[model samples]
Target: MPSPAAPPPPVVTPFTGQFGLAYPIICAPMFLVSSASLVIRAGNAGGMGAFPALNYRPLERIREAIRQIREESAAPFAINIIMQKSNRDRYRHLELALEEEIPLIITSLGHPGEAIRLAHQGKCRVYCDVVGLDHARKVADLGADGLVAVSYGAGGHAGTLTPFALIPLLARHFPLPVVAAGGIVDGAGLAAALCLGASAAYMGTRFIASCEAEVTSTYKAAVVAAGCHDIVNTDRVDGYPGNFIRTPALDALGLEPSLVERILSGSRTARRSLARIRATRVLFGAGSSRATYKTVFSAGQCAGLIDDIPSVQQIIEETIRHYHAIKGTLP
Candidate 1:
């Protein structure tokens, strides 16, 4: 027989078909890390790429970034938006995304009903990131096209439950597609998510080590050098729980801001904005900070899987290859 017809390849799910992606992977829209180059490269490599809308300033820059991605690659990409009250410019970013006619929108930190409505009006798909079943049900009722189960061990404002528990919980209840996030760094993780009934995987920490990522050499080096034990979860940054590599600088930061500090901040929007600025400065080296690289670094438990920094294309291709290789060995 003619090679058994190559086993007919894997069945394409609704996610891959609807988005026209070759693989069921989404490069999480990591703030300050996922840049235009990373997004374009990931898309060209047959997986969906994304970046945070807040990464760009003045709105026009984001428009230009979108234009550049479209001009350079035909693969689908997404823009992430913080939907909470702190993101004062959420609607402004949404309007810009709609104007650009972007392919996908990922909403986090708040309700998705308004976003789902506006995205649908613009013919774009909206996927909300949820930490638990209640959040999943809320987003589903709001007509979210998909749900990203942000489980424990994820980087940058991670959830509380483990993927083993979170993915199936959402899959069992929600009728829409589910994307598994948190601690997913390689093809094996992707395969596990699929086995759990998730249609795709959303990965952020792994991409920080990508050649296309906007992270510095110090950040990349830290991720490569660290292991799961080095990862720490704290609420000091942004007033919410987030994962990061343990360091002296991180240790020195307070676990949570004081109640008086919260009250004196005038408004919720102002407090959130200020918190973000502080976090960026202390952790990401966004402003004048010389010790950012050595003293602070954000990462997930998946750092254990990253051994080398590779190009986006190489990463995606190798991941898919490994997935097939692993699947071939199974009955």
Candidate 2:
């Protein structure tokens, strides 16, 4: 008998064309989780993969990671840089990103004009993460190529507004492509984001459960076991709101740092450094003694959708397949 016809591909928008990707999906540059191997695999799967610049220490290692990704896959990838003044290595990493001529730069935490300018000079695209309409407008005015609407239920450093609200707000105000983030773990969420006016979906928490992610099996277990309600928003991590699985380590944090405590921590650099150390120990180190996992795991509300650990290729392919299935049923 003749072979049955293959299913039609997911709808391709300008985002897919601009980034040379088969799907309008971008792997979020999640710190610690977004490893070089993960990025390479995502790119090979016809999606734009990304890794946080701070994931590599000594700065030079970032360039090496970028080179490794380039050598492994011809597909485009992105590098994320925290634009806060407290990030002492921000400028150094930016320099390396420009020198390497990275394809995309994802900026978060603060204004990204300098990074945008440098990325533009290297003929690279800049996508800034914004939680609100005001921030979106500012980044657009600063010449950002795109905006990542990091809405409520995101894993780390999340915003208050839901994707439904933030995506439309930014899309209406700016002509740049809008990438929806937060609580997008499966194909249905991806399709919903597109329907809400996002050109692409930027997923982080779901990718954490992928095999290629540089995380412990324990971390993956926590993610797999979690649901939307299990995720908690706490500002004790780094003065910004972040979603994390509530564990003994998190409870021990007591409460958010007071203004006096923040001031007493010293200057901006000192406070940032101290916060980084504390965060590293609590989240990545052994602090959560009571739970099955000992790390402070971060996950989006979409954790409910993550039932098993899968390969990056599997995740992307399944997401696209489900997306098409959902689209076919739509009017």
Q: Which candidate comes out best when scored by lDDT?
A: 1
Candidate 1 per-residue lDDT, tens place, 150-229, comes to: 99999888999999999999989988889999888777888889999899888888899988888789889888988899
Note the Cα lDDT for every prediction shown: 0.82, 0.82
**Candidate 2 TM-score, C-alpha based:** 0.88
Candidate 1 displacement at residue 33 in angstroms: 0.4
**Per-residue lDDT of candidate 2, residues 275-314 (tens digit):** 5655444333435323212346778888877899998888
In candidate 1, stretches whose alpha carbon ends up further than 4 angstroms from where it belongs are 1-11, 254-295
| Candidate 2 residue pairs in backbone clash | none
Residues forming the 10-long window of minimal summed lDDT in candidate 1? 2-11
Look at candidate 1 and give me any clashing residue pairs. Answer: none
Candidate 2 global lDDT: 0.82
* Model 2 worst lDDT run, 10 consecutive residues: 285-294
